[model samples]
Target: MRIFVIDSDPSFQGATVNVTVLPYEPYWDETVEGNTTRYSGVNYNLLATLCQALNFTFRRIPTREWDEVAHLVEIRKSFMTTVIYGVLPERLQRWDFTFIFEHAGLYFAMPTPVIRPSWLSFYYPLGGYVWLAILVSTLAVCIALIQVMVNEDMEKVKNAMCTEQMQ
Candidate 1:
């Protein structure tokens, strides 16, 4: 019952609030009939306590998914609820989120090398096309240098110059 309201009407102390929630796992979910949300997880559990403290009746409007809620919030929906973990810059621009119900830390699985360590790994970052381009360009530079050397001999100068100019 501890909901936070930011209205400048001192006369309005006790009023009902409609909050749309994005169903997420145990935090909040609908019973098979989609009539009411069953709250058990830490986020919704805390929300229950907050609602009690704030002394306001809340109406629940469940959204399809988190992505859908994100889109709705982007379009500036009238009411917002659910477990918002972080205050990202983009989210801040559209809405005013004032609650931090939980904190999620980053966790990434360490990649194991499928192939044993070898010097060949140096090319793993480059795509096949890039390697092919490098090989062709190197070969082209070598051929041009050889042509320059052949042209210096005077005998093949006209042929090399013709090939170089293409005219």
Candidate 2:
């Protein structure tokens, strides 16, 4: 049997990078075991895997809130962060993102809307004065039509009386 040796890369030299961690459940969880702080979850696992594969180490940056985590990364207080931030357009402009390995779905729900009767749409746009105007106009037209019909009937009666006298 032959003996083999593996050598570490000189580029990384096991440099420690600063990483900010927030205890987001399912993605990140920070636990205290005895005196040492232990982190476990999907995000942390990914970070650990990257460090191991790249031959580099990372130091945890302490933060209290989600905003602080982003602030630390934004202000260069940390080299990176271990959390799943939504990839927004503004965020993409400021930072580089890795390929998406996981997805979380968001849904918006509201109470069912109250539906008014469809016929009510006709009156919705009109106010009290406008509706009164329409009613008056319609009645005026009907009265005018009745007057014209009555005048025509009187003219026929007069013509008949004149014809009978001529006979």
Best by TM-score: 1
Residue-by-residue lDDT tens digits, candidate 1, 1-167: 89998766433245566666766767775565467544556556666666776766666655777777666656655355766557889868866777765676777998886794677689887899999999999999999999988877876777789889995
- TM for candidate 2 is 0.55
| Per-residue lDDT of model 2, residues 1-167, tens digit only | 99976665534568999999887888888789899988889998899898888878899888999888888998998989867777889989987888677775777999886676899877876899999999999999999999999999999999999999999
Q: Which pairs in model 1 have colliding backbones?
A: 1-49, 1-50, 1-51, 1-52, 1-53, 1-54, 2-50, 2-51, 2-54
RMSD of candidates 1 onward, in order: 8.3, 11.5
Candidate 2 regions exceeding 4 Å error are 1-11, 108-167
